[model samples]
Target: MQVSPVDDSLEQTELRGPRARTRKLMLDTAIALMQKGQTPSISDVAEAAQVSRATAYRYFPSQAALVHAVVDAGLGPILEWHSDSNDAEVRVQDLLKTSMPRILEFEATFKAALKLSLEQWAERQAGTFGDEPPFKRGHRVEMLQKAIAPLKHTLTEFQFQRLAKSLSLVYGLELLLVLKDMWGLEFEETQDIAAWTAGALVRTAIAEAGV
Candidate 1:
C-alpha cells in the first residue's frame, strides 16, 4: 500500500499529542482554501492540511461541519476584540464594525455558512411559526440586555425597554448580510458604518427615554 505523504506528515504532527494544534491546522487550511475561491471540499482540505481523509473527517464529518468550524474559528479574533474592550459602548462598536471586515476576511466560508443559516432560519420559521432559528433563540434579546447594562442606572423602566429593543434591532445577521453582500463595503468601512449606526442608535434610544 502506498502511504500517502499527507497522512504521514500529519501522523508526525500527531506524535506531539496536542489535539488543538491539529484542529487549528485543519481549520487554517480550510480557510486558506476557501479564500482562494476553492470550495474547501473534504479531500482538498485534507490534502492541504497534510492530514489523512479519515483524520480530517474525524474532526469534521461533513462540508457543513468544516464550514462551520472555519466560521467559528474566524470569529475568535472578533470575540477577543469584544472581550478586550470590556466597555459596553466600545464593545458594541467593535462588534458592529466586525460584521463587515470579519465576514470579508473569511468571505468564502462565511458567505457559504451565512447563506445556509439564512435558508435554515427561513425554513424553521415557515414550518414552525418561528419556534427556532439557527442563531440561538433569544440571542438578540440577550445581547440587547447586555448592551444597555451601563445605561441602566440612568434609565427608567420604559427607557430600559426601549434601549434593549434598539440594541436588538440595530445589530445581528441582517446587518452582516447587507454590509457584506448588498453594499459591497470593505472590512474597515463596514466597521466604521456599523460603529456609527450603533452609536447613533444608542443615542436615539437614550434620548427617547429622556435620559
Candidate 2:
C-alpha cells in the first residue's frame, strides 16, 4: 500500500497519541509474526497486541490493509530513497545496492505479503474475494520510474516505460526470492547479481536508444 503524498500527509495528521500508539503496536506485532513466517490476520495481530478485535478492525479494516501496512513498515528507508546522480545506470545500480540489503532483512515479511497477494488473486479469480480490498503491489513501478528518470529525455515514452518494467524484474522481493531461494546464492551474491542485471538493462536500453 504505497501511499500518495496526499495520503501520507493525511495519515500523519490523523495518527496522534493513542491512535498512533495503537497503530504502531498492531504494525509491530504483525511484523514480528511475519518475521516468524506467519501470515497473521487482523485478528491475530489484535490478539498478539492484546487489543480487542474491534479496535484492530478499526485500525485495519481487512487482512489486505493489515498486510499492506506491514509491507510499508518493512519498506522503511527504501520507500524514501533518492539519488543526486543524473545518470540512469548509476541511479539504478545505487537503488538496487541500497534497497537489496533492506529487502533481505525483511525477506520473510515480504514473502508473507506475497503469499497474501497470491491468495487474494486466487480468491478473486474464484469469485470468493467478497468485499476485501485488493492488496495493491506496485511500489516498484514508481521507484523504478524514479530510478531511470534521467533516461526520459533519451528514450521515447514507450522505451522508458519498457526499461523501467525490465528493471522491475530484477528488483524487490522477487529478485531476492529467486536468486537466493532457487539458486542457493548468498546475500552478497544475490545483491551483486541484481545490481549487475539492473545496470546491464539500463545500459542496454540506452544503447538501443542510440543515446
Candidate 3:
C-alpha cells in the first residue's frame, strides 16, 4: 500500500500528540498573560499551564519570541480577512462587519501587543535591544489598496488619497470603540455602515472630480 507523503507527515505529527498539545497550552497561556500587559516568566506560564519549564522553553526560547507569538495570535483573524472576498470593496465591508467586532472584543489585548512591540522597537532604535518590531505598516497599506482598487476609477490622484485616508480613519480603533461601546451598534449594523460609507465616499469623489 502506498501512503501519500503529506498524510505520512500528518500521521507522524499526530503520533506526537501529547507533546504538541503541551506546546499549544504553553502558547495559549502565555498569550493570555501577555494580553494583560504582563509577560509570563517561564516558570509562571509552565506552572499555570500545568506544563513543565523545559516544555515551555522548548517552544519559546525568549520573552521576545513569546511576545511575538501573542501579537500573531491577536492579529490572526484580521490576517485571515485577506482571503474573504475577491472584490476590494466587498472584502473591506466584510472585514469591517466581521473582523472588527472580533478585534474590538479584544481591543485591549491588541493594544497591549502593540504597546509591547512599539516599546521594543524604540529600544532597538536606541541600540539597546536586538528584536525587530511586530508587523509592518506597509502590509496594512497594501491591503487597503487592494480593498480600494475597485473604486479607483471614481477618484483622481489627490481625491483617491483623501478617500483612502477617510476610509482608514473613519474605520479606526477609536471610531469602532465609540460605535460599539457608546452607540451600541451591533456588528451587522457596522457592516452596513461600512458598505454605505464606502459607496458614499466613492460617489462623492467621483462627483467632485467632475467624472
Candidate 4:
C-alpha cells in the first residue's frame, strides 16, 4: 500500500550526466588552448571539444564567463589553500611553496587570462565597451590577510595592508612574469628570490612595528 518517492532533483541530475561531462570537456579544452598562449572563444572550445556552439553557449553564456571558468580552474591549489600554523612566516612560506609551482606550471594560461582582463580594462577606459560585466580577479587580499593575521595588533591597519599587498606583488603570476620573464632568471632561482624577498618584507614590517 505504501510507495517510495522518486526524487525529482536526483532524476534530473541523472539525466544531466552527459551534459555535465560535455561542459567539463569544453572547459578543459578552453584551458588547454589557453595553456598554449591562445585566448579561445566558447565557439573555439566547442569545436575543440566536439560540442555544438549552441550547447557551449548554454553552458557558459558569454566569453567572459568561459574565460573566468578556465582562469578559476588555473588557480588550482592556491585558491583553496589553508594553514593550521599560527606562525605568520611559516604560513607565508608554506603558501608560497604550495602556490608558486602551480602558477609556474600554468604560466602561459594564467598570463593569457590576465591579458584578457587587462585588455578589457583598457577597452573600458576608452569607452568602446561598457555593457558587459567585468571579469573578477583572485582573492589574494583575503588569503594574505589570513597568512599575516598574527601581526594584526603588532602593526597599524595601514601597515598590515601595505605589507600584505607588497607580499602579493611577488606571490602570484606576476612573480613568474617579473623574475623569470623580465629578469631572465631560471626557475629555481626565481623561487629562491621570491622567498627571500617575501621573508625580508615580513621581517622589516614586523621590526618597524616594534614587535
Candidate 5:
C-alpha cells in the first residue's frame, strides 16, 4: 500500500488536550465575569479561572484579543445565523426576532466590547494607542446584506446597500443600548419596535424601487 503524507496543518489549527481546555476555561471565565457586568482583564480572568497570568497571556496577548474572543463566543449563534425565506422582509424579521433575545442575553458582554472599542478609538485619537490589536466590530453589515440578498435583483446596488445600512441601525448592540437603556423599554417592546422598523424599511425600499 502506498502511504500519503499526513497533513500537520490541520492538527496545528485544532486546539486539543490541555491547551484547548485551558483556553476554553479562560473564555468561560471571561464570559461569566462580563455577564455579571464586569469588564475583566486577562489577569482577572487568569485569577478567576485559576490559571497563571502567563498561561492566560499565551492564549490572549492583549485585552482586545480577550474581549474579541469573548464577544465571538457570546454572539456565535447570531454570527452563524441563516434564513431560508426568500422574502427580504421575512428574512429581516426572522433575523431580528431570532437574534434579539440572544443579543439581550449577552447585553452586558457586548456593551463591554463596545466600551473597549470606544476607549481604543479615543486612545488612537490621542496618539496613545501603540501596536495593540484593535477590537473590530461591524458583523451586522454582512448579516444585513445577506438578509436582504433576495432583493438584489429588484433594487440597484446603491439601493441595496442603503437599505442594508438603514437596517443596521435597528440591529445589534446599539439597538439594545438605545431602546433598552436610553428609552427604558423592556426586551419584548424593544424587539417589537425593531421588527416593525426593519419590516418598514424593507417595504419602503421595495416600494420606492417599484418592486
Candidate 6:
C-alpha cells in the first residue's frame, strides 16, 4: 500500500492505538449524526462522542475538517483500492464494480459533505469564508491512473488521461444519483449501466488509440 495524499487529510498527525480509536470515534459519531439528517458541529460531535472538546478539536480542527474526514471515510475502498492485474480495462472494470456500490451505500454521507462544500463555496464567493481551504473532493485520480497503468504505452499521454477522466462519468456519488434518482433505475440496473458505460469508454479509448 503506497502512501496516498488522502492519508494526510484523513489524519491530523501520526495517531497511535487509543488516540487512533478516539479519532475514529469522533468521525463515526459525526457520520451517524449526518446519517440522521443533521449536520453536526465539531462541538456537537464532541458532546455526542463523550470526548472532550479540546480532544475532539485536536483530532478535527473545524467542522469542515470533520465533514471532509467523514466524506473521505464514505469513499471506502476507493481511497485504498488495489488491483494486481496489468490489464488496464479489467482493472477499471473491477474497480468500478467494487466501488460504485459502496458509493451508493453511503450516498447520504457524501451528499451531506457535498452540501457543506457548496455552502462553503457560496460563502467564499461572497467573500465571507475567510482563508479556509476549499472543500476538496477528488481522491480518485491516483487510483484511476493506476487502474489504467497498462495503457500508458498503448496511447498518447493525453489519450490515456482522457480515458481515465471519462471514467468519472460512470463512477462516484453523482453518477449514482443521476442513474437512480434522475433516471429512476433500480440499483442493479444503475450499477449495470455504470459498469457498461465504463467498459464502453475504455474500449472506445483503446480502439481510438489503435491498441
Q: What is the C-alpha lDDT of each candidate?
A: 0.65, 0.90, 0.66, 0.85, 0.90, 0.83
Give the TM-score comparing model 5 with the true structure, all chains together: 0.90
Model 2 worst lDDT run, 10 consecutive residues: 1-10
Evaluated at residue 163, the lDDT of candidate 1 is 65
Give per-residue lDDT, candidate 4, residue 165: 93
How far in Å is the alpha carbon of 5 misplaced in model 4?
25
Q: Write candidate 6's Cα lDDT for 90-164 as tens digits.
A: 999898888877877788888777787888889988989976566777777776788888999998999989988
Between the candidate structures 1 and 4, which one is better when assessed by lDDT?
4
Q: Write candidate 4's Cα lDDT for 108-181 as tens digits.
A: 98888888888889998898876767776766777788888888888999999999999998788888888898
32 Cα displacement, candidate 2 (Å): 0.7
Cα error, candidate 6, residue 46 (Å): 1.6
TM-score for candidate 1, residues paired by index? 0.60
Model 5, span 13-87: residue lDDT tens = 656667878899999999999988788889999999999999999999999889988988888788888999999
Best by TM-score: 2
**C-alpha RMSD values across all candidates:** 8.9, 2.3, 6.3, 6.3, 5.1, 3.8
Against the true structure, candidate 2 reaches a TM-score of 0.93
| lDDT by residue for model 2 (30-53), tens | 999999878998889999999999
Instruction: Kindly list the per-residue Cα lDDT of model 3 for residues 1-211, writing each as its tens digit.
Output: 1225668777689658887777778888877876676756668788989877787889877766676666667767665555445455566676566566666666766666566667777877888976433433323454456666765766677777777777775464556556666789986676577678866775676678786
- Descending-lDDT candidate ranking: 5, 2, 4, 6, 3, 1
The TM-score values for the models, in the order shown, are: 0.60, 0.93, 0.62, 0.88, 0.90, 0.86
